[model samples]
Target chain A: MTEPKVKDNDVVVPGEELASGMGYLPGQGTYRDGDKIRANRLGLVHIDGRAIKLVPLAGRYLPKSGDVIIGKVRDVTYSGWIIDTNSAYRAMLSLKDATNAYIRKGADLTKFYSFGDYVVVKIFNVTSQNLIDLSMKGPGLRKLEQGRVITVDPSKVPRIIGKEGSMVSMIKTQTNCRITVGQNGVIWISGEPKNEIMAEGVIRKIEREAHVPGLTDKIKKELEKTNKGEQ
Target chain B: MTYSKRLDGRGFEDIREMEAKVGVVKNADGSAMFRMGKTIAYAAVYGPKDLYPKFLQDPERGILRVNYNMMPFSGMGDRVRPGPSRRSREIGMVSKNALLPVINLTDFKNAVVDVFIELPQTDAGTRCAGICAASLALADAGITMRDLVASVSIGKIGDKLVVDLTYDEEAIKDMDVADIPVAVIPSTGEISLLQMDGIISKEEITEAIEMAKRACVKINKVQVDALKKKFEVKKNE
Candidate 1:
């Protein structure tokens, strides 16, 4: 029988024994050491069925393909744009992938997307050489306007968005704010200044408490308290 | 041997009072502050971001750079000059090497991780405390590592071997015999950094290493506890 050495939410350090035996499979944040699995980082242990994974509490974002991210246009070349994806790798968005419109040679690309403009885009490809390709042709992909952006731990983005976007949608409806969560941990919230600050606070709370069980319910209660205070 | 006793009235194998806290710096990716008795050191880690200057970028693995600085008022003496001295540079290099073995740099190709350790107050064994703080800071920054590095200083005072020499003992004029500092990855029982000063017999050196290894196991537990406390979940409030 497969047995887990650590229970869910147990804080584990590097080289700590995670599980033993052939029935268990090592997952992210874990590596097999002989007949036992060991944690490769400081994180919380997560046992899911036969797989044991560790969820890191800290670290920089590692960019992957097909992830929706928010980045600032760092430079605009003749054919493409260099975007800062908040990771070690910078992303490139060609004019063709950025939009469907046909463009003539020598067209001014700066007019379309200039320096320092934050855009919501999706990663189209990531090469073994760490080269990243991004595209703006997707639903809700556009330049961010009049929204204050805050960054959290990128790994906590999933918790902030919740299952099927329920958590974010609840925040939007309660505060009546437009919220965009980039997989890279960049969040843009636009609404009344008061509501925007409230939304930002709630998002930060989620990021800090991502490892806690029943976090969704806690955030809901927090939103209710703020709603009552606002009325 | 009559004057070799520690000022604090502790046993030869006892370490100084050690305390570690992570996420001390708000702006840093990861930060930790460690205190050993009266000595205090703070470390902050930044990046895994792009390597700059172009010439130093490694294609296969990330480069690790460590800067160890001691404030002019950190010790009880005529003020030291602020900035990197020859001594600080040597300490920084050894500290960097101690951490390099554990950090998985290949995962972050063409990037750099910078660790800055500041000695706000120091007695003896400051480098060991700095290493301890740097490891916690790296872990807090979420850098993947094979294991955590822990270090301690073991020295021979007259004929007795002692762990974690204090400032007064380190400064003792002609009385102290040998100062050995060792950094190790406890899980693998590998020594990443070792330094020996003064005179020690071959047999004594082996014994001192064994003593340092035992001390390391205790220090490693402290490091792990600090990391766990940083990420511990708080009750709903």
Candidate 2:
């Protein structure tokens, strides 16, 4: 077995050799050339047993099925609504998957979700041709009310949400704000003016320091400080 | 008329004082500024976003567009017009071709990636520097690429072959030589872009290509270093 040349968290550039031998399968962000596995992007390298992959540091969001995303209604067609999911590929929200209500033909679709309204939707399907289909019938998926939206690095979404929902829940409890984080890097916060600002600050900090070790602890400390200030 | 041999008092094989910085344009998705001797160039990348004009959208792969431009006062002579002249258009086309193969366009199907290269100071090798900066910018954007493209120009002066020609060296109308600018993907040893001017024999072309390849290896190292520095972790103060 050939050992991987780079360990986890080690930064790698495109075309850098990861491993050269049999038994080492090329994974995401890596390509195979003969017996050598080489990186095809700039990012941190991860070696899992016999598989090697790279997680890119920065990139636009690529829509995937089952991902909960925040989308803006760009246009409303007769059959569906064209949604911008903060990705290169736009998503379609058919009237069937959009809501459970029955609607007559030529009825005003804009009455349901007007142009520029943000909707929390889940990607139901992403075709090989990059066509995206979204669903609004899922739980916690609906139109966003009055709130401020901020964008972050899409790759940092996992960090912002934390392991499970601990970090986001902690922020919500401390700031008394309702927050919804989209997997596409858009965060919606709604609460009292003061609490909303506080939540925004905490979320921005997470986005900025997402790559740092022990980030959860750091965020916890910061939240504690803010809580004390409120009292 | 022997005049200081060449500008900057460097040997034929020596490149100019080169430096690069990534993320120079904060608002851009990715950006890089590169300097080769006195020539300065900046490149910014936007998208993999939606392609407008519905007609131009390709169902198979993303389209890569490069716009190469120069500031009105960048040249040594009178101010150049601030628009897409014939020269800029040609350079943009070649630059786009140079970068097309390295990027994984299929990853962002039905999208477009725009690269804008702007030269604020003109010299002999602006296009080469632009390619270098654009490559860095693309990598900074985290676009999946097979390899970084490194570019340099080799010019034959009198009886010697020189790397990275200066403005004065390029303007010599009486010299019997060739000025060859080449961009290469060093890892794969693939020539992505190549342009030549003046007269040269086949043997010289081969020799020049080999020399450019060696120089590209060095340039690729610099590009990697700059990227590493940009993403380097800093300890808490």
Best by DockQ: 1
lDDT tens digits, residue span B57-120, model 2: 8888889999999999999987989999999999999999999888998888788999999999
TM-score of every candidate's chain A: 0.94, 0.95
| lDDT scores of the candidates, listed in order | 0.88, 0.88
Per-residue lDDT of model 1, residues B1-237, tens digit only: 555567789889999988999899989999999888888999999988988898898887889999999999998886879977899999999999999988888878888999999999988888999999999899888899878899999998887889999888887786756789899888778999899889989999899999999999999888888888776635333
Estimated TM-score per prediction? 0.96, 0.96
Model 1, residue pairs in steric clash: none
Off by over 4 Å in 2: B1-5, B234-237
Which 10-residue window of candidate 1 chain B scores lowest in summed lDDT?
B228-237
Tell me the tens digit of each residue's lDDT in model 1 across A152-228: 88878988999999899989998889999999999999999999999999998888778777787878888898799
